[model samples]
Target: MTEKIAVLGAGSWGSMLAAILNENGHEVQLWTRSAAQADELNQKHTNRAYIQNYTFPENLRASTDLETVLTGATEILFIVPAQATRAVATEVDRILAKLGQRPALIHGSKGLETTTHLRVSQILAETISPEHRTSISVISGPSHAEGVVKHDPTLVTVASDDFDAAQRFQHLFMNDYFRVYTNADVIGVEFGGALKNIIALASGALAGLGYGDNARAALMTRGVAEISRLGVSFGANPLTFAGLSGMGDVIVTATSTNSRNYRAGYQLGQGVPLADVVANMGMVIEGIATSQSAYELAQTTGISMPITEAIHAVLEQEETVETAIHHLMTREGQAENG
Candidate 1:
């Protein structure tokens, strides 16, 4: 059955997901905060702001009006930046409550908001009614919008506390080019999705420093250790760290040139200032906020995440990358055990 889907945000990932849903025969309403962009999509069938090369499907409609997007929206897929999720959720909550029904939600944003230090789903629950919590799902994986727009084969995960919702999203979005898997460990999935961006930045920094495969491999492996240790402290399943949202996402984002975090780190490693790096990237590199939240989360949870700490020092505290590296290298050694 064709479902009415609302994709909020008209950025690369949002446009790509809208295209995917439209191709799947669902009625898709892709919303843009910018009225100009929304008009362009309606007129040109393309999002000039992000996915400039590809055309949106004919079945895909767009609007700048939030209410229009919410009209008959059975499921809301939020593709906004991580920092904007809370504000968007707040807006959605107010409107949805007035409507007297809540749609299932799928957040595609990755990273924890620095101020709140809450994952996307947590932010949703906090902004919306608690009764709506179980209806939230997260779709995550190694998906990069650059590839997904081209109809490239990509694997993603749909995770929720509600197994039925997970399976529903799996069926809703999965396609020959896009494969979706369902995982019931909501916290673990969200944590892995949010935290791995930090690791990607570290790996990008390593690659930016002219480090080879061995260095990136070491960073990726150790990054998982740091993320898993932190997640375990917060009641997440340790094994989830080894799954798609964890190791899988880390590998893809850290190594790929298309990843905003990796690209930002690459420039940073190449001696660009943080501000310059961010300005040049031209998209939201979630790792910036994730790095901040990871540091705060580690300190709050008493988890010793040296890598996350280093990233925090470099990005937030404006510590030199050299200084951060030296600090990491000089850490005291301990036995590797549970």
Candidate 2:
């Protein structure tokens, strides 16, 4: 069942998703605010700005005009930054409102909104009209944009409170290389995906400090515990923390050089300024922004997330990474479960 799909955002992930959907025989329109990016994608069939060295399918189209992309799109995939999600979703509401079109909504972006702490699905639900958003689902896992674009073997879960909707989207992106599974626990999946970035930042800091694998392993294991504790407080199933979005995502993001969060943390550990790290990266580092939100959320919910708190101090409160690590290490010991 080939459908018309509009993929908003022209970054690496959006470009790759457009390529995959195009290959799947869907009429895929990639939307970007950058006219240059749109022209390059439509003319040269390459999004070298983000995903380098990969030629996009010629049939995959990109445009700067929002209405051109959304006029008849049956499904919309949001791959923009989490901070940018609400703005794009609001525009989606305006356009689809006029067209009287109801499209399936799936967000591949992960991160809690800064102050609101709203998940991507929650923002979409609150912004888009009820008539238009009968279903809002999320796709998340260990898959990175660079890897997925290269056809790396990747598996992810699509989640929704509406189980049937989740199953429907499962077939949309599933291929031999990119397999999809259905999950009903949207809260656990979103929290897992969002919170793992903070841990990855800490892991990268360990790597930067020349700490061995032992340090990274300990951080990640304890990171999962912190994640599960908070996720459960938010009504998420604790076992979900053991699944793909949690442990699987945490492993890849924390250990891999491809992760922007890890790279940012690595630079922080090397005494680089936060602004410099972010500017040099030339991409959104979700962890830096997410750390503050995660820390604040933990405070409001009275959840103990020492790792998250430490990283938030480093990223937002001007505490040095080394100092944060020192504090974490010197904290009073407790039972393993505690």
Using TM-score as the measure, the top candidate is 2
Write candidate 1's Cα lDDT for 66-155 as tens digits. 888887888999999889988888988887877765689899888898777888988887898855434989999888888887778899
Model 1 TM-score is 0.96
Q: How accurate is candidate 2 locally (lDDT)?
A: 0.90
**Model 1 stretches with alpha carbons more than 4 Å out:** 130-134
Q: For model 1, what is the alpha-carbon lDDT of residue 329? A: 79
Runs in model 2 with CA error above 4 Å?
A: none
- Clash counts for the predictions, in order: 0, 0
Writing each residue's lDDT as its tens digit, candidate 2 over 1-338 gives: 78999999989877887888888778999999999999998899888868788889888888989999998898999999999999999989999989999999999897999999998899999999989866899999998888987788998899999888898888888888999999988999999999999998999999998998999999999999999998888899888889999999999999999898999889988888888998999989988778888899899999989999999888775688788889999999978887
Q: Pick the candidate with the highest lDDT.
A: 2
Error of 2 at 232 (Å): 0.9
Q: Per-prediction TM-score, please?
A: 0.96, 0.98
